[model samples]
Target: MSLASTSLEYIAYFSEIVLAIIIGLAVGAVVMWIGGYDPWQAYYQLFVPSLTTPYGIYMTLSFATPIILTGLTFAIGVRAGLFNIGAEGQMYMGALGAVLYGAVSLPFFAYLPMEFLTGILLAVLWGFIAGWLKAYKGVNEVVSTIMLNWIAYWIVETMRVYVIPNPIDASKTVSVPPSGRLPLLIPNTELSVGYIIAVLAAVLMYFILWKTVIGYEIRVVGYNPTAARYAGINVRKVALYSFILGGVTSGLAGVCEVAGRPPSYAITTGLSNLVNLGFDGLTVSLVGANHPLGIILSSILIGAMKAGSRNMQIFAHVPLEMVQTVQGIIIIALSVPGVVRLIIRRIRR
Candidate 1:
């Protein structure tokens, strides 16, 4: 790419980030105004505390850890010309794999590595099913993945609540043994090594996608499958690799949540807390422009919003729904850059 073109692309990215934040905040302000709340104060609670306070920082990192992995999950799929909507289901299966390992009592080294690998393999197979169908049977990946998601959900849910039954707490999966759990970063806090893994995963993903031969082929296939096929690339192989790699990252995310967060190294019976992480990952990928570094930054923003939502409610009296609204506005802005461009065009004219 030419220097000028590269510079313009950077400018456009900057514009998207600025415009999305501005639009989300502006709409959120209006919503808060209608509800007789102070938008500025609410936003302060939403953004500032996550950075300034120790506990908030820990919680934000805790939340960001998994989403970073999941964000990369979708980001990788996007780069490989696949839309992996089944990250949620793959995550569940990954959790189940780890949970099964959790039931055993092994040394720390054996348990941690084995459990994580088991989770990754399970999720990879789960995602590969959809990819295989698309590659071989001409099935729509979206339809196949969506159906696989529900199949995974019921399978895991039934196993968690009924099949295993926790022997004590029927509503939650049995906790991971201490030796199998992730090591904590801070003493007596929820912070763990998951954040470090997340950062490394992002770095590795960025390197692989931009710096490797296989990655080059995958990107080429994504950019133009016909061209790639003409060049003798095995389109089916690339597609399966894309799906499986995405699943690997997502599976790592599942084990992170299960092993990193202390005092609750168990999956719950219902989808109350673990809901829509995959969709949130899709949102993060959109907001991040599907770049690894960008994904990490966007995941941080999302983690902050989630970590601080309760504080916003308690201190600023803003409803939790307002935070959701702000996120929606951001997603809308990112999804339809034309809206921002139209406003900019009118201003220029």
Candidate 2:
């Protein structure tokens, strides 16, 4: 496609996303009004504080950190024509890998890098199972990934409670060593350099997808596997690569959550800090139109909603569930245009 056409396509997609946001907010307002709450006040509490205040923005970005990576996991899969949802399981493995960082002492320079390497390696291995199965045995990725998620949850949970249990807390894994932990970007806040890492990862992904040869192959396979194969692209390799890449990002997210986030800096007994992060990324990926750069902006928006939801409940008397409902509505609205476009594409084909 020509550059101008590509630009136009992006603009159109952006416009559609904006419209979806408007429709979702309008619908949410109606729902709030019907429930006897002041919609305007609820929205004000939901957004203004988070967007306008420095502290709130930092919190929002901190929250956005992990999801940003996980969002990339999902987005990369979609680009490769795969519905790889193994990020949840992969993230679990990643966290466990980071937890291993506390098990042994190392030099300062090696400590942090080892933590990242181990976490990413474990997540990649976990993702490999599903990828190999799908590529070689034709196993359904969705089912395999779902089962793997549960397995990862239990495995990580057992390990956290047994092998890596914090000696003092007994409810969470051992904390990352000081050298391994990401430095805080803001004093006394969860904001850390992890946010910067996430942004850089997004930028890296954009470069890969738009400018690299392998990325072009992945996109080609996604656009049409048969055509890709006929054109001499290794379809199976691309599929496997996509899953491995997903694992890389998801694992990074897990590492960041445990090593970067404040307070515990460890996985809890129930994996509370890491739970639902992968699924939430699915929403982020969709809202961002499965684009890496777009995911950054979308993650912030989603993160803001999460940060503000508490304020909405406390100040506006809006139920937290209501905020969640609005998010669901937004996701549905955002998905509609993509679904329609997909249908149209299929019809044309």
- C-alpha TM-scores of all predictions: 0.92, 0.94
Model 1: which residue pairs collide?
A: none
Q: Put down candidate 1 lDDT per residue, 222-321, tens digits, no spaces.
A: 7778889999999999889888888898898888888888787888867444567877777777677777888888888888888888888899887667
The segments of candidate 2 whose C-alpha lies over 4 angstroms from its true place after superposition are 339-349
Clash pairs of candidate 2?
Answer: none
Using alpha carbons, what is the TM-score of model 2?
A: 0.94
Candidate 2, residues 1-349, lDDT tens digits: the string is 8999988987898899899889988998898888889989988988899889999999899989999999999889878888888899999999889988787888977878998999999999999999999999999888999999999999999999888888999989999988999999999999999999999999999898879998999998878888999999988888899999999999999999999998988999689999999988887887787899999998998898878888899999987778788767766787676556555654543
Q: How large is the C-alpha RMSD of every model relative to the true structure?
A: 4.1, 1.8
For each candidate in the order shown, give its overall lDDT on alpha carbons. Answer: 0.81, 0.88
Which 10 consecutive positions of candidate 1 have the poorest summed lDDT?
338-347
